[model samples]
Target: MKQHIYPLRTKKLKGSIILPYFQGINGDRMVVPFIFWALFPLVLLTGCGGNDQKPEAQQGPPPKVKVAYPLRREVSEWDEFTGRIEAVDSVEVRARVSGYLEKINFVAGQKVKKGDLLFLIDPKPFQAQLNLTQAELERTQTKRELAKNDLARAEGLLKAKAISGEEYDSRNKGYREAVAAVRAAEASVYAARLNLQYCEILAPIDGRVGRELITQGNLVNGGGEATLLTTIVSTDPLYVYVDADERSILRYKRQHGPSLEGVEAQLEVADEEGFPHHGRIDYIAPSADPETGTVKLRGVFANADELLSPGFFARMRIRASEPYNALLLPDRALATDQAQRFVWVLNQEDKAEYRRITPGAHVGNLRVIKEGLTGQDRVVIEGLQKIRPGVKVSPEQITVGGEQ
Candidate 1:
């Protein structure tokens, strides 16, 4: 058998090669050459199928981001608590003498000074009693003068021996009885005078007065079962009462001094913004309440403008720690992952890296970094969402107070 080799001609179709069947010179079919010709195109196609030279991968420009070094400054931590406004001096004005309420001397809600008249009970009855006592005193005085004259005569008679010793003793006893009567009358007059004075109720303290509880012309029961006439509370230099938990109290003792004498405090009311009133801790309960596990604290503030009032719902913050150097970052730089908090830190290679940090109270617009960061660390402040861990970044340096 003679082996015949067919010359394979390749035609390129687009990017592929194609082969056509060729007839043999003899009437017999040439299977071997046809097979070779069919496979020739495949061989050529396989050889030229893949380019050894691959196009370089297109790299994107590094994401632009704003970053800054952590701020290093002295920071003080504050502990906040719910509190209430209280007056330094509060009084419930009541009538001391029973009579008809003749006048409400002070307007409701008006500021009054000490010794200012607040109410007036009808003085007619008290005045009449005083007059009666005074008249009795005058009569007692006449009797006392007569008794003294009689005692003088009795003493002279005893000295001259003209009257019996028993008679002189009797006359001296009568004079002593008249003197006792006069003393009793004088005491009654004093009491009557005091009752008349009490009819005019005077303010015991300087404060703003509440509405009159007993109006004019109403029968008022005084001294024995005194009727409440009004209430007054000091307007300036108010007191604020707050309850602090055991943990916070202990922390305060550890950070600040044991004594709360000068510990500074700031307060804000429900309708107010940031704490505008400043004060100092003036009192601390000697013992903690077992039921509530808290200690009572009192602060004094100057409310000269009368903006604060007693019984106001207030939010108070006490300085618990002294100012110390701390690392701080903008609040925007912080990120939360499940239960953990982290920030994107720019490494030496200018790549974003994840760093878990412990956060603390906010100081202005920045948050104190309690842990996991240092003053030298540069953290991404803006464009946090645009990058991820280990991604290259073009960090634009910014000042610490730029956004603050």
Candidate 2:
């Protein structure tokens, strides 16, 4: 090797070293300097090691979710329906005789018993007519008495030949006519008496009366189209009319042997919470409505306090099954996939698993589970949207309260 040293040129550009090229006469090969080789590796290694490294981040624990076991209870399934209150006996009070209404004897919305006076028609005309008929009846009775004496005399005259046969026959005929006249007058008297009694309109049923439609001094028409004076509806024992679907009625028939008589029922009004009023199925329509496919039903209830009124909208529930043990779950826990309803249940590994369920009636806030659930399975009630299948969860067990 020639011991001749060339002028070295170097640069430190962007943390990398640049070397000047030296041409040798032999040009056997161009080789990089040892300093450049060693420094090139150092540059690469230093470049790779220059990135600021942060401590590896710590992963947090699994997401927390609330879970609960299914509520097992004894429940009586009931089929609910919307209905209306009706009266057992409803009557329209009207005057029977045409006359001026003299007095409205009952206060509007008052309780009245059968035979209680409700209205008073003018009785003067009827009374005068009755008196006239009675006087006429008395006159006919006197004439009958005189004719009877004459007939007796005529019979004696016929036997003794004191009078001719034609005269005796005439006397007998007069006596018969007089008796008929007396009977006719007596019949007139009875009719007049009935008319006089009709002047007072009385309650035909025990019930609460509505507001009087016609006021006092109004002439009430007593003929074919009678006046509607007021209305009365029985209150002690009332009825609830419901139109039940034919399908449900058929299901009930299968359970109760084709007759729904005496089937117990419960009811609640529009503003009520639960079914507090109790009654029984007193009537069921013999046929189903073709248009709506519903059957009519009537439930009779005791209204001792007269709290329930007719025409009130109500919800009625009829027992579908007796009390039996069943599993229940929260309705909010259910997840839907098109037509399917599913839920996320935790397995022994604390991982979420999908489950399909069949739901029955709704008891309070809980849904009766007809199938696809066991009491041992822990179901995710809260944080359902935050989880996926096989994802681990930190479950906090909770207890459900209130009615099942």
Q: Name the candidate that leads on TM-score.
A: 2
* TM-score per model over all chains: 0.78, 0.81
lDDT agreement of model 1 with the native: 0.88
Tens digits of per-residue lDDT, candidate 1, 31-57, equal: 345667669898998799776766799
TM-score of 1: 0.78
Query: Which regions of candidate 2 deviate over 4 angstroms?
Result: 1-60, 156-173, 402-404
lDDT (Cα atoms) of all candidates against the true structure:
0.88, 0.88
**1-404: candidate 2 lDDT, tens digit per residue:** 86855444444457576655554555433546779866988799778987877689997787788899999999988899999998899998877789999999888999999999998899999999999999999999999999999999988988999999999989899999999999999999999999899998899999999999998898998868788899999997989999998778988888876668899899999788778999999888989889999999888998999989999999999988879999888888888989998999999988999999998898867889889999898998888987889999899888654312
List clash counts for every candidate, in order. 0, 0
CA RMSD per model (angstroms): 9.7, 9.4
